[model samples]
Target chain A: MMKTKTKIPEYTSPLIEQIYEGISQNTFDFVANRMQLALRISEAIKAKNWSQKQFAEMMGKRPSEVSRWLSGTHNFTTDTLWHIEQVLDIRLLAETNQESTPIFEADRLRKFVLQEVNNALEKYLSSRKLVSA
Target chain B: MKFKIVKLSRFSGNKSSLYSVIIDGEQETLFDTFIRNNVSENLHEVEQIFATLNSIGKKVGANDIFFRKKKEGKAGDGVEAIYDYPSAKLRLYCIRYGSVTLVLGDGGEKKVRAWQDDEQLSKAANEMIKISQILTQAIRDGDLSWDGNDFVGQFEFNDNDEDED
Candidate 1:
């Protein structure tokens, strides 16, 4: 039954085109974030050498519920994510403001550099105006 | 019943190949049918599922955690399901060949708790399982062969299920 390579049909249609582009960007972002959270939870569980069921017990959720949560479509609340972080001791969300974290200092430094650059540009513009005068 | 295994171009990427089945006499693929039926009531769930599919097809590899993993996977024939979990409003069944290839099948609102409880959902899942078996047999018999990204020796599937198109 082996024959020469045949072309597989590309199943693109108008409806598919509409659906692919029709969905809102917000929906896509929500899905991507959910997937990332699910992956992070799975990874944390794996790193701890614990099965999903064990992780579920630690999180005080049913194994079935945990499985559903990892299906990449869960509308996770901030409370649930925080709980997961506590149970797994894994950081899923970045700190908005934490003085001890290196990111905070780096962000501060970046802001200072931007302000300095703006001041230097203002001085250069004033000098140029005076020279033209 | 007869169907054609068609690869979806928009979702296909370097990471994985997304496929769909077009029943004989149908104008669009099974995945299209799922989207058309649920566009009005379950638009958000539909969009989320589409986003997940697009991600799996492009950026992220088709990891098992992203899906129900195996509604019929105990058979070990790649029969799986995908949906925006917790909502469980709609479920799309498919056949996965490892993480590289997937054949999207049509789905219906899983109003009941189990697919077996709802006749329509059962039919959708079962149809994909039948397709999975047929495709596996075709590869074994040399009617279809792996051509890198997808099976390319033949697109035709002479499945004998008495299901409606």
Candidate 2:
């Protein structure tokens, strides 16, 4: 019997290029961290089969407020983070054993920076070539 | 669909990097124009969208921001070039048709409530629907022709055309 393969959705975005061009690594980490938290919360809510309304009720907040919170933009404060963890019974923040945050790891950040710089330089060279051509 | 990218610097005061679709020869660029205007809170979102499109034009043939499936009926079942930033609460809508033409529509911050609760977004959705219908019909009626990847021939839209009625 042959195994049927599930297709993995490609998450490429044109904005990634712009992000590389305009944003700093710290900014990237900040946005990515927030998105990660939002995803986790969203997944946990889905796993519990709860609607935003239900979750809002549990959190003693309005549905509209919860909707914004889960919209992947809400900057979670420490208190709110703790409160959510308490309510969801899930940890929203990672507690790494490393001395520094894993996101700021020297090697990984260096690789990402190099890749972005190379992409920009490559684009610049190509455009210059087109202009001269 | 497919399209020959038409650079829009000649017809506008905006950056040369911006692109729209040429159906036959008419520029179907309402979306690009809206981005040029860049109203209110969407200023940042529109700028980001513009840059994203320029980047996509250079590197990938089409990427997520260039072609995205939108909510059927809500967006008239058209493809959208989303400028989705949760922090900004913004989305810009677009529609591509006949493999060679794309038109843009206005979009703004998504209401926390729902789209139906907001009049502007609803209007934008209606605009997407209207453009989609017009472009598709034009292709079906042989008023527009595309060679899978590029547009060919000439097109003119008459205000009093029977299609409008």
Candidate 3:
């Protein structure tokens, strides 16, 4: 039998390699979240049948400014985000109940992990008893 | 590799927000050189700039105000990446060939307050201009094609044009 070899393409630049190497998971998340926000804004405008110009007018900004905003690199401030939410009448970021939602979620996750661990331990003990018997 | 235009950002008004030339050749790209010399040196300010550029590359249409026109002219003018840090004065220069094509040039830490005062940046700008001229000629001679958005060509030093500087 003959083995076929696969050739791997090398990147042309060390700069590109360094840049790629420098990018962390946090940077990926940050870039992804920004893109998601841009997509959401565009989708909301499309759903309302609003053109870029119309959306700009609604937002009280120029079409060019709105265009930049939707370009996926706008460092959106919290105030600007709130304004966009108000004008678009859609929640862009996920809103959670202020009270005990996060705490409840953490508690639930802990309980689920604990349950799984107990189940695994029980299975191990039952197998040991069987082996001894 | 050849000269390919990667739209760093969407079109705004007469031109796209940013365009970085993807120059891949048998030899290393100018971008590659720029990254290697500066990135490995590990200067804090320069690292931030590269990191920002990396983040921008990751995002769709990652154009921001940090990229500004080095010269006040039409689409095919000089452009530079304005270092975003308030205290840092480094400029990454390039050449904008069309509505959305930029050839990356060498960049350096800004020494003088005025861009003109900085000899390094001026030299970088000159190099970019020369590449832009070569690209323009290549396109005119049918060696390169501008398809309304990007300049498509086989950018080899050995191949088409004889007018090498």
Candidate 4:
């Protein structure tokens, strides 16, 4: 007898496609990128020999919620992302520096070196004066 | 603080390379480098690496040498290697100092290992702490949105409404 085929759940709807594409092209590639990342997280959890229930407890979320996140069907919010970062302890992005680069130009290097030398000389003189007194 | 790229290596059989960056005198961070030879590949591995590093309390920043290239949009100017996987691609930038090593990358699936002296391990650990702090802040701020992508909305069918009608 032939075995019947089980139907796979339709996880990718038109709306999901739109969202995936929109985020992939418009905002950040992280939308679809996150799906794979979530899978990796799941794998990492498994590697640690933790079950979904245990992971949920660790995350302070309901097991069902963890299941949803692992399922890759639920949409994620910024707050959720923040929570994930807090719980996972990872930096998902890089910080931008506000300072301009010209400030570190080699032309100013001499001034900084002279200032440091002067400060060191002042400290040494002060220490010597205190010792003598 | 001044930063340096120290080591670049391939993870598994992928094309992306894992990177380590050394900062100031004591801190080290890991990153997934995404651009190699001026090409962009799958960044999923980089993201995974970031997640893993973040989960462990590593901080990341653009100023970190691991993620910084000599020139942006230039092919092979400073990027050492590129790792490509089915899900994503990654570039690796390694910064080494004394006995410490730092790794950096774009979000991708690549992994990297760096060789450094035992004396540098302490500095590497300190670097990891600083990187972890940066990573934690980035994750908290949702600054990881790199591709400029987002979910627009969700629609659900209302069975109860249909039944009432």
Candidate 5:
């Protein structure tokens, strides 16, 4: 009996490797993760019913450049990130738990109180006018 | 000073009840006065809105005044000035201004229209301006912090076999 040898295909994961390499080179494991971040942003743009052309116009770039970004073919620069944040009108990266837990809670509570006060005032004024007439 | 509400039904849709005031021969848009009077705890919202508007090619002149293009009018002329805070979906427009403010709402149609005669517009505008000032300072001073995602840290996992060698 003769034994047959099987050939295995050689595959290099360029995208995966790029992400790994980018992560390894970072001082604190930040930056260079733009490829993954871009995917999230692209998803958000679609969810918001915004087109690449509109986003490009907002960023003052041509539609082709935006196309490249969405395709993940282009490495994003810091300037581009800033522009994206501006155009999307969202904070892509916020300090992780930077504020004390209590402080954050207090801020939330304050907002609620203010909203209630405004609502009450509005209601009172409306009723007062109705009564006068 | 004595004040009167100039009906703005001609400009905005019938659903919108818009009015302005005339004071001392000067017109102060109600929306503008509201922003000028209100104080905001979170200036971040205001800053973000202004930046978004500015990025979208909205015209902003000195004093942070944003002008919206008139549907049909001559160049450099607009029927309204809109201050939009996109984060809150809150927008205020100045139809006319004098001693009393005549504010209109294009964003929060129902809420803003209901408070056409209230002083809330002035308070909200003031708060918005305060927030804008803080945002401007943050940008100018570079006090804005970048998200942690920008910095990457690495760890090496050494195998026991490699250590034995």
Candidate 6:
């Protein structure tokens, strides 16, 4: 509890507030990715004019779960991120598909295989049309 | 508990005035309690929270994009919990008065799957809810109002009676 009916102190700068100077690169990256991702997701949700409840339904999650995601507390799994990407139509894991330094080998290969299959289908359809003509 | 709101210079800026709650009979504000409890145990998350606060205070002006709206849809301007998104074990709850004013409450580690399962977090969040109600009533009565940076008029409220009733 606080003091009884006392005047609140005038705003005073903290005396010698020690900042987190010399943050390690690893920690920086870790924190940055989490914060940025959370912000991006929240922003996207707001842009689409969906409340957490609506977004949660879209992701097939409980509203509480989506609240945690935006709270920056949810340690989003790759699967959850993928689900979010699908629902929001945003590339949260875009870095994973980078041409250089690909993060997820299996996922990148899956995309590559899908592209190849689509290209083959297109080629076959075009050749059939040419032969018929 | 009755409390007074005070502006914190460390987290304050031209764009926004960050505030903390100091409950009656207590020496520390909720923000102070938050730092005292977690500054040693979870320095990394503490730093991350500080960075977020810095961005909110200095850059973003406590926008909704920076806060997680308490999905409860309960009143108090929809109390929000402070988090850095990508990772956090700690959670600081707050009520954002638009973009320029943020009132911070105490926080602790989320030891369970949901914050409602965590006593400390629930208390902190509940406190914010109460504060939000008080603030909303105050604004409605014109007892308090935001003046860009700091609050003008009566910023203090006694809610012990209401709590008892």
Candidate 3 runs further than 4 Å off = A1-10, A31-75, A87-91, A98-133, B1-27, B40-59, B62-66, B70-75, B78-88, B95-102, B146-152, B157-165
TM-scores of chain A across candidates: 0.62, 0.56, 0.58, 0.42, 0.43, 0.55
lDDT of 6 by residue, B1-165 (tens): 477888877767776778888888887678878866766556556667766675567655676756766453264455887644445678788888887988888878877767677788878877888888887776786667766657777656786664332
Tens-digit per-residue lDDT, B131-160, candidate 2: 566556656766555554334432334324
Against the true structure, what is each candidate's TM-score?
A: 0.75, 0.44, 0.54, 0.24, 0.25, 0.61
lDDT of 4 by residue, B33-68 (tens): 122211223223433333323221222211121232
In model 2, which regions exceed 4 Å deviation? A1-29, A96-133, B1-31, B39-43, B47-91, B94-105, B108-124, B131-165
Best by TM-score: 1
Q: Model 4 TM-score?
A: 0.24
Docking band of candidate 3:
incorrect
Tell the DockQ for candidate 3.
0.07
- Give the clashing residue pairs of candidate 1, or none: none
CA shift of B90, model 5, Å: 12
Clashing pairs in 6: A1-B23, A1-B24, A1-B25, A1-B26, A2-B23, A2-B24, A2-B25, A2-B26, A34-B86, A72-B85
Per-residue alpha-carbon lDDT of candidate 3 for residues A43-66, written as tens digits (9 for 90 to 100): 788899999899999888998787
Tens-place lDDT digits, model 1, residues A17-123: 75566655655676777777777788888999999999889988899889888767677788888899898898877776855868988999998678657654653
lDDT of 6 by residue, A1-133 (tens): 1113333455532311443332333344555466567778988998899987999888888986776676544578899899888888888885656466456887888886786576546535543443343
Candidate 2, residues A2-114, lDDT tens digits: the string is 11122211122233233334434444455445544665787788888988689889999998677667644476788888888998889876675758766668789899789
lDDT of 1 by residue, B25-142 (tens): 9988889888777765666576667788877887665778776664543567567887456645888888877777888998889788777778878888888878888888877877
DockQ of candidate 5 against the true complex:
0.01
- Which pairs clash (backbone N, Cα, C closer than 3 Å) in model 2? B1-B99, B2-B99, B2-B100, B31-B104
For residues A14-105, could you state the per-residue lDDT of candidate 5 as single tens digits?
A: 32122222221221122213334655677668777988788778778898666557532255677777778877776766566675688889
DockQ for each model: 0.25, 0.04, 0.07, 0.01, 0.01, 0.10
